[model samples]
Target: MAITCGLVVANIYYNQPLLAEIGRTFRLSESEVSLVATITQVGYTLGLLFVVPLGDKRERKSLILVLILAAALCMAGAASAPSFVILAAASLCIGIFSAVPQLLMPMAASLASDEERGRVVGKVMSGLLIGILLSRTISGYVGAHFGWRTMFWAGAAVMVLLTGILAQMLPRNQPNFQGSYGGLLKSLVTLTRDLPVLRRSALVGTCMFAGFSAFWTTLVFFLESDTYRYGSDVAGLFGLIGATGAFAASFAGKSADRKGPDFGINLGILLFVGAYVLLAFGGYYLVGLVVSVVILDVGQQMTHISNQARIFSLLPEARSRLNTVYMTAAFLGASLGSLSGAWAWTHFHWPGVCGVGLAFGGMAYLLNRFYGRTASVIAPAL
Candidate 1:
């Protein structure tokens, strides 16, 4: 399941490192090309709000298989697109259907015992994060050696394989919600309104992912700049360095299981702040960039695992709905971050990007400090 999650989620990120290549192909401005990332995230947010919620109301295995197949077709479409508009439209479809991972996570939580839930979630999320990191690495190399179209074709093939494997191996999860789809959608509002932990987790996740997205979306441009003059292969290699954070996911999960999730959450925010501080000097030195990548990824994963553990524990029956609320907000933040990162890069360059990231980290820290206590208290009981 973890591997499958990682593979599907990887589709959304392959375009990041290839942004320069794609832009060159279409003769697009940096701002126009950046919309590929932003719109993909927007499509993901829509999926979270609409498709992921169906996890609770449908047979999960079948749902996952169907979505994976759809995503594969979308990837094919992206690979064949002759114009930027066609590619962008295909990217949106890919984002919408690649949400199979979100469905898998809640299903994993449902299967695990409370005592081991965090650990289980951590393991699966490690795969997801590693996929996020490695997708860039793989795509960067492939897109550089072959054309960008080849990378999307490769992703489509992988998704087809995953679809077959998951179809055979995945367990059937009976629908928990018996209501109509309309009611299921309506209930999302009620869940958000009544659950303080959901609200806080969603807010914190939003800010953290915004910072994360900002860094990644602008990184290719920064690397291509005169200051660095690095290629996509080097840009992709950073993903390997960032994989250090995959280790933090398991540790954070175990830590949350042993202690309360609050400790890990707080620690994550501090690391986020420190990461940006280091990244502020990244343009000057390679070491600064490497160290910042490790710190930033670790911080982001830690916060993510902790927030998820807390939210999953809140509603046993409503795990998918809770995830829907949390992830929708997170991806919405990602969309905003990608847009803002492109803008900052265009107008102010690397330092401006770092400033935006720092502001986002600061906002997350402040939100947690102010509301975390109340949310924590209400979480376990919800």
Candidate 2:
């Protein structure tokens, strides 16, 4: 499941480091090119709303297989695009179908015992996180060497192979939801309304992800700017630097299991604030940027892992719907972050990007500290 999640979710991030290359290919302005990344996130959010809830109503393995296959086809389309518009359209479709990991995650949660749930989700998430980080690294090198289209071609082939392997290894999970698709989606709203923890968790996760997204979305542009005059490969190398800290994901889950999700979450948020402080002041230096990437990634993993552990404990039967609500809000933040990062880069450069990241971190800290306390009364400590 971990490998599957990693490979599947990597599709959403392959465009970040290659954004500059894609823009060059199309002769687009920075902000205009950024719509590619933003539109992809918007597509993912749509899928979370329309597709992921079916995890509770359909056979999870089959749903996952179909999504993966569809994503593979979309990747092929992206690779063969004749125009910028076609590439962007393919990216949207790829994002929509690439939501397979969300389905697999809830399935992992459902299969695990209460005592093992956090650790299990964490393990799967580790793969997902590593995939996200490494995809950029690989795509960067590939995009630089073979062209950006090669990365998408490679992604399509990998997904097609994964589908065959998973079909044999994945366990068959019976549908737990007994209702119309409309009813399943309606329950998502009801779940959000009734659960304070769900609302608080979603908000905190959204802010954290927004900050994370802001940095990544503009990183290539920052590296390519006059201060550095670097290329896409260097931008991709940061993904490897960030992946070095992704192992913290499993530690975060263990911490959540042992000390409660709130402890891990607080620690993560503090690290996030500190990372931005470094980026805001020291980002002009390559060494400072490298160190800050490690801190930022570790903080992101900790907060994300703890947040998932907290919400997954809310209702076992509704785990898919809970995830749908949380991830939809989070990806919406991602879309907003990408759009804003491009605008900030256009207007204010690196300082503007750092300012946006810090603002997001501050919002996450305040929301988690004040609102999380109230939600804790009703939420399980796990």
Candidate 3:
């Protein structure tokens, strides 16, 4: 399940490092090519809303299989797209169906014993975060050496293989919800409305992810500037540095399991803020950037794992819906961040992008500080 989650979720991130090449391919402006990342996140948000909730309403394995097939086909479409518009549309489809990881997460949570749930989710999330980080590394190298289309084609082939493996290896999970799909969807709102913990988790995740998206979406542009004069391969190499966080994810999860999630979450926010401080001052220094990447990724992973650990503990029967609400808000923030990052990059360059990231980090810290005390009550109820 961890391998599957990582492989499947990697699809949406392939475009982040390839935005420049993609722009050149279609004769697009920086702003226009940036939309590729923004639109993909938008599609992911939409899928989280319309698709992931079905994990509770339908047989999960079947739903996952169908989505995998759709993702593979969409990847093929993205590889063959003749125009920027067509490619963008294909990217949206890819994002929508690539929500398989979200399904797998709740399934993992449902199957684990209470004491082990956070560790299980953390282990899986470590895989997910590794996929997110390494996808850029792989895509950067592939997109630079071969071509962006080739990268998509490779991703499609991986999806085809994953489909078969998952079909055989995945255990059958009974549907948790006995209701209409509409009722399933309605329950998402009810879950969000009633659970203050859900609300707080979603808000914190949104802020962190917004900052994360802002940094990643504009990173290539920063590297390509006269100061760095680096290629996509160098941009991809940064993922290796960021992969340091994957280790922290497991640690954070275990910490959450022992010390409660809030401990890790508070530490994560502090690290996030510190990472931006490094970035803001480091300018184009390679050492500074590397340190920032490590801090930033670790911080993000810590908060992410802790948040999931907390949310999954609330209403076991509704893990998927809770995930739906949390991830939807998170990706919506990603879309916003991507869009804002593009605008910031175009108008104000690297400093502006860093400012946006720091601002997001600040907002997240404040929200957590103000509401976190009360929100702790929501997690232990289950």
Please give the distance, in angstroms, between residue 382's alpha carbon in candidate 2 and its true position after superposition.
22
Clashes of each: 0, 0, 0
Q: TM-score of each candidate?
A: 0.97, 0.97, 0.97
Q: Write the per-residue lDDT of candidate 1 for residues 219-333, one digit (tens) a residue.
A: 9888988978998878889888899999999999999999988889999989988999898876458888989999999999999999999999987888999999999999999
User: Candidates 1 and 2: which is better by lDDT?
Assistant: 1
How many steric clashes does model 3 contain?
0
lDDT of each: 0.91, 0.90, 0.91
Error of 3 at 236 (Å): 1.0
Q: Cα-based RMSD of the predictions, in order? A: 1.8, 2.2, 1.9
**Runs of candidate 3 exceeding 4 Å displacement:** 372-382
Deviation in angstroms for 371 in model 1?
A: 2.5
Cα distance off (Å), candidate 2, residue 251: 0.4
Residues 1-382, model 3: lDDT tens digits: 8899889999999999999999999999888999999989998888999999999989999999999999999999999999998999999999999999999999999999989888999999989999999999999999999999999999999999999998899999887788889888888877776788888899999999999999999999999999799988889889878999999989998999999999999999999989988998995899999999999999999998999999999898989989999999899989989998999999999999999999999999888778645543433221
For model 2, the superposed segments whose C-alpha errors exceed 4 Å read 372-382
For model 3 the local lDDT of residue 189 reads: 71
